[model samples]
Target: MKKIETFCPVRDILSQFGDKWSVLVLILLEDRQVLRFSELAKAIPDVSQKMLTVTLRSLESYHLVARKVYPEVPPRVEYSLTELGQSLLRPMHSLIDWALDHKDECLK
Candidate 1:
């Protein structure tokens, strides 16, 4: 097997996934398979429409989320995790589990 480079810039990777909304969006979409923009907005109750748009665009740019457009009278769009994004499920779940396990102590 070929060695993958570990030298890719950490700052860039951090910037991509480090944001609160980005992680939340990724987590919400992980098990759902796909979601429309309005569904995402409802799922993440505190997120503003603008923030949702920005986060989705950023994820799309990173090739982490696939945005599909359906040709219809009103036009429909759906977001789903790409293969790369799905790979994040294990680590994201670990983080969520850790947070839940420590929430009371950590927040105190």
Candidate 2:
């Protein structure tokens, strides 16, 4: 097969979810259903709070994640996937499963 030299716009969308943090956050949100900021922080200790905040904001901008805040003194914030985001789960899980199955070979 010959490689075509062309710019693909799909790269823009993929770029958003291609990062490790984005993938992790999406996976976590999908599995947990809904999670608070602190809960997410606890779940992903490797990621800095700032980075997670950025990731959540990015997802929100893309309409893939929905964030809700409750009116309270301390403020209660929760994150979950939007309907559009939910639609992406099947393919995302498939990709995840593929990676897991190929982990040993890829790790080498």
Candidate 3:
């Protein structure tokens, strides 16, 4: 086994992937090329507007997600995964698949 040297970056970075809301948001974005704020809210019925906003802002800060705004009287905004975020999907999906396959074992 590898020695526990210092703070492992894997654990540090896994926080976002482990977050339910974050994972859901990323999955939704991947399924839906782009989504408006209201659309995302409707997609995730249980999440509060405040929480969704906070989650999007956090993802935006990490540069893993992109937010685009349109100049219109009504003001339209859309969200999509950035290239880096798309790259992350591969590894994330692998972990997700593993979790799903071992769900029963994990729950025990």
Candidate 2: minimum summed lDDT over ten consecutive residues — where?
1-10
Native-to-model Cα distance after best TM-score fit, residue 48 in candidate 3, in Å: 0.7
Candidate 2: pairs in clash: none
Scanning candidate 3 in windows of ten residues, the lowest lDDT window is 3-12
- TM-scores, all candidates, are 0.83, 0.88, 0.88
Q: What lDDT score is found at residue 93 in candidate 1?
A: 82
Cα lDDT tens digits, model 2, 1-108, are 534434355678888877898888889998999999999999999999999999999899999999999999899999999998898889988998999999999999
Cα error, candidate 3, residue 39 (Å)? 0.6
32-101: candidate 3 lDDT, tens digit per residue: 9899999999999999999899889888887789999999989999999999889889998998999999
- Candidate 2 achieves a global lDDT of 0.90
Segments of candidate 3 deviating more than 4 angstroms: 1-9
lDDT of 2 at 56: 94
Q: Which candidate achieves the best lDDT against the true structure?
A: 2
Predicted candidate 1 versus true structure: per-residue lDDT over 1-108, tens digit per residue: 534565457667868876999998898888688999999999999999999999999999988899999999799999999998998778878988999999999999
